[model samples]
Target: MNRRDTILVADDVEINRAVLRSIFEEDYNVLEAENGEQALFLMRQYRDSIAIVLLDLIMPVRDGYEVMEEWQADPSLRGLPVAVITADDSVESEIRVFDLGASDIIGKPFEPHLVRRRIQNIVSLSQRHLDQDDCIREQARKLRESNAAVIDALSSIIEYRSAETGQHIKRIQLFTRVLLEDVAANCPDLGLDESHIAMIVSASSLHDIGKIAIPDAILNKPGRLIAEEFEVMKTHAVKGCEILSRLDRMGDRDYLK
Candidate 1:
């Protein structure tokens, strides 16, 4: 009952357009186009607000196929749902319309109730997909925030057990982000995108986590380490690797790994 969403009806015949309008005008704002060119014009003019297109396959000027071809070619318009309404019920016509990305096809002399139901279904399904995508993106964002919090906590623990401070972890993430962003800009072939950079910057916070396992005497040494103690300090790298190996087993927590 949301009259805000518009339905486009493109047909060369006046009676056909009038009949279709009567069926949908009660629930939706109907935009009528007597030719394909007019239909395309209306679509471009109100692309974002139009919920679904009821296209006639045999319209003049551009025709339905031409309109569909243009729609499919434009990435921005390709996702909008369309339904073909025509007298041509041939299998070839159906296959051609489907191939051109129509969501449904209704033969002419369509039952008013059936036509309305079919168009409603297509719009409803499309809206559901858009809603689901929004939900997924929200969940992913929350997951990323949770992962960052846990990483920061673990890094703080490592700093508490060693000579390092919280600023050290901050500096590591900052410097890693700077370098990765440079790589993304200059080395496009490497395919280092924003998400990749974020994951790597987060992982850098765990670089010295293995120090948590080293003895306090060696980990927080006041002076320079001796050769024997230096060897023990170097083992933190291997220890960090071991700790991370355990994280790999956490299902759907690849960010931790």
Candidate 2:
């Protein structure tokens, strides 16, 4: 498998295109475009294959600014690296290109070796950023799984003590998720996204966590309790709050706080 990255050289001037093509041809596959329209066409067709773009600011059809604008409008094209090849070295031109998402700008009469190094550096940096993002996402996934396991274990201890079926916990989670989904869909003002809904559903499993503080006699009693016993049972909510507060302080857990 050929692992070489493809570089698109978009310039109206044939000599300029030839120079860049000759420079990078050994290390990369070169695609030439005489105008921005052709450049955009080739970009869309070989979007995954193209690694970076070398675009001329002044072109016959669309020009570099228009090309960058169109690229920015399309979400998928936004991440593709582009470097503007421009004769104008003014501060305004530099700012405009940067705002339009050009990774780098090569001034007119740029050294061949320097251009090669700059393009390579941008590609390397972009790859590093992408790798870091993947690492962060994987870490988040593992953290979520670990949190879920701890919650299930803690909830199960309370269930076992109270002689309640595991289905009781599952049902509460299910109901909470359903209601949250409904609210999210019908009430956009609530600002409940998928993450928020998932969090609330997971938290619903801990509603009976307070039962862990209640005496087994009161917790597992089949008959109605006397007023004094009932009042003691009512304290379970406050007890759960106290227990959670203590755990938060001890562990310094951000979510608990």
Candidate 3:
């Protein structure tokens, strides 16, 4: 991604296009479109590259109004800042541009310094918004990794305390991957995408987690358990649910039970 700012100047009048480019070219990579058709083509090709669009309302072959309409229909293009440059300086013209959701309006003939100032301010603000979104996404990724690590460590501790091998927890994770893959393949109704499947694999260690609390005599005895012992063994699922309920923000607890 080219993070440097780019400005697209779209005008039918060659002189007007040159003037706007001269004002912005020193600070930004400037692109020119002689007509609205060409403007739309450039915008599509370099939507992510461009930060601000300088649009001329009265251009030949699909005017600025139509270009605005096209970009506004698609979410990606809609967020880019658009400054309407118009020969018509009437209050009605400015109001219409505002109604069409332009970032700013410039009237011809423009002072180069004022044009420079407006583009600089708008591009700076747009860059800040993109930076904030990137920060939020990074924070979310770190949080998920931390939570997964805590689950893995705690589950391993549970397995060790029961005189069980770590392989017990490993098998739980492996079986969970199979079940989730089946859900992805055969059950569109479940709506379980890869992210949901990933959480399942991370948290499957908690499925037998409540076995940590059962008496060793009932849990590890080689012989058949009596009715009372079997009933006690059954309680591990409920105990697992109780453990989940005690935890903060573990999402849905029904899966544990």
Candidate 4:
């Protein structure tokens, strides 16, 4: 029963607001708005904290439709659960309210228990949705961390096998990051978000990984490679692709592709 799990009751009639507040106040923090404008104001102020809105169709300043329209304009508010309340029991009105994205419509002279149960159901479902989203975000974060670790380990193996300086990989990563930033700024059409940029930077270390298959004598030679030696070096591209193909067969993440 967090104070932030607030239930907003927006109605032009004071008695209805009072009755609704009494029903919800024990389990939730109750907010009363006598007009649509006031309701919208409260909703914006408590957007993150308010769990559900008990909205009235008829109100001064702004109606339920107006408030929902404004709220839905902010993409985050598309999921904000709202229940429309009205004294008019017309089927057309109920259909219109649902079309406006309300969770449910409660006709006036409704049973107190029914109203309470409907609101509790909406709140429970909303909380479950939020919980699921949080879990998914956490799992994605862990997966990214695991992928980075494995990529670094493979890069280190390639660097060691090639007799390359430890600092070589570091410099390549830094250069890749700077170039990615420039591309993001100047070439906006590339549509590269942070995650894509990160993957590219990591994969850059694997560019010369095919060198791992070269002989130690050729790789460690002090002078320029002879024609025969250079030809053998060109095979690194095919070797690297073969390595990646094997890894792909192991069911690696799609980002590796």
Candidate 5:
């Protein structure tokens, strides 16, 4: 869909190469090689742009097997799919080509429609992999943005509820984030990234967010809590967990932990 994909056709016969090229040239950028040696050279020269290869088994100098081996050995070329196009339709030929990493096989007297279909399928699959990678990157970006907003909101909630200065929440958040990073580095099993650390620090601010639910008489008391008042104070952790846990906005409980 981006543009007509390029294909390299490797065959010893000039007539076969010409016919194949004529069929594909309308929808593809075509390159031809008379033998395996030329095919490998063209592949290297146009490695980035070429999408697939239509290879023939019998050729002078280097054969198809040797070329396939060379392609598989190179890390850059290893994943490029090759469809073997040869006159040999023997069982041994099919098995050998597949073992050598040919993704597909097309017998000689090449059917134009079948050749077109196989090439399209390989190119489509490659494009799908590219699309999936793009989707993953986009999702990661959105997750980071969501985590940042949650952290800011949690910090605001803490500042609003506490008698301490507004900067108190910000300081505590930074301290918690540093502690989380230290833990993550010292303990690789935690698998914590910067986003996870941010979530944990943000959720830590909400550790006392349930205080908003408590009565002012108990919350703003200047004196130490009596037994009855202490009972009310102990409820904050559970109450905080309940309140934050119910919110669809928060990501996971590890942050609350």
Candidate 6:
């Protein structure tokens, strides 16, 4: 019921742990562990408060895979969403983690904003699971409401960072909703539904969210950017994609869908 949720960050490296801690500490209550054993112990001690776990694959005593297996074996902890935050990028490792009951995996050397979005999505999902009933309709309704709130909040943050008016987000949401509806009506085979439309509308507001990372001179320039400035502008799309990609792993495929 708390506005801000709690997150557990488990990593062997002090620098990695500090980096993750710094990302979420301001917005969420963060619990840290140096390795898998400490992570498991903390989970057991504060199981109720912990909403999600950001786990590292390599550790001294009991690795992330081992911790995941242990959690899956325990009835009480089986439902907890474990997101692997590892440097491993191999296809086999990804498959293995999913097979081991990990809910998501994030590759390391990550962007701070991307990490924040991912943690927020997983925390939101975990909270929804706890608060909503088992019925699909109820779950869907709760998800829609939660997603709306999240997208709105994120858009507001983006707007705050830009010189553009807040109406930009509002207009984008309306336009995107209409455009998606038209698409769904014309292409039924695309599997676009109310859920998909809502996601599109919500996510469209973020299409230009990465512009916030751009320098004000380029972002707010009245004229076209030069070759170098245009290249910098292009990074906004990549940044936006990265931010949404991390959230995609948290089970909200709507953004990237």
Winning candidate number (lDDT): 1
Q: Write the per-residue lDDT of candidate 2 for residues 1-257, one digit (tens) a residue.
A: 11227999999999999999989999889999999999999888777777899999999889999999998887557667899998999999999999999999998776999999999998888767666766765665566676777777888897788656478988898989999999988885555778668767877777777878888888888999999999999998998787677654333243453
RMSD of each: 6.9, 7.1, 7.5, 6.6, 9.7, 20.0
Looking at model 6, residue 234 earns an lDDT score of: 91
Question: 93-164, model 1: which lDDT tens digit per residue?
Answer: 999999999999998897999998888899998888777866875676677776667677888898778646
Model 1, C-alpha of 240: deviation from truth (Å): 15
Write the candidate numbers in order of decreasing TM-score.
4, 3, 1, 2, 5, 6
Alpha-carbon lDDT, every model: 0.84, 0.83, 0.81, 0.81, 0.78, 0.80
* All candidates: TM-score: 0.58, 0.56, 0.60, 0.61, 0.53, 0.51
Q: Which residue pairs in candidate 5 have backbone atoms (N, alpha carbon, C) closer than 3 angstroms, thus clashing?
A: none
Kindly report which residue pairs in candidate 4 clash with one another. Answer: none
lDDT of 5 by residue, 60-153 (tens): 8899999998888776576567999888888998888999988788887978888788878887887676667667656755764676676667
Q: How close is candidate 2 to the true structure, as a TM-score?
A: 0.56
> What residue runs in model 1 are displaced by over 4 Å at the alpha carbon?
1-4, 147-257
Give the per-residue lDDT digits (tens) of candidate 3, residues 97-132: 888889898888999888888878888888888788
Better of 4 and 6 by lDDT: 4
Across 150-175, the per-residue lDDT of candidate 6 in tens digits comes to 67777887887764647787888898
Model 3 bad stretches (over 4 Å): 150-257
Total backbone clashes of model 3?
0
The weakest ten consecutive residues by lDDT in model 3 span 248-257
- Model 3 TM-score (2 dp): 0.60
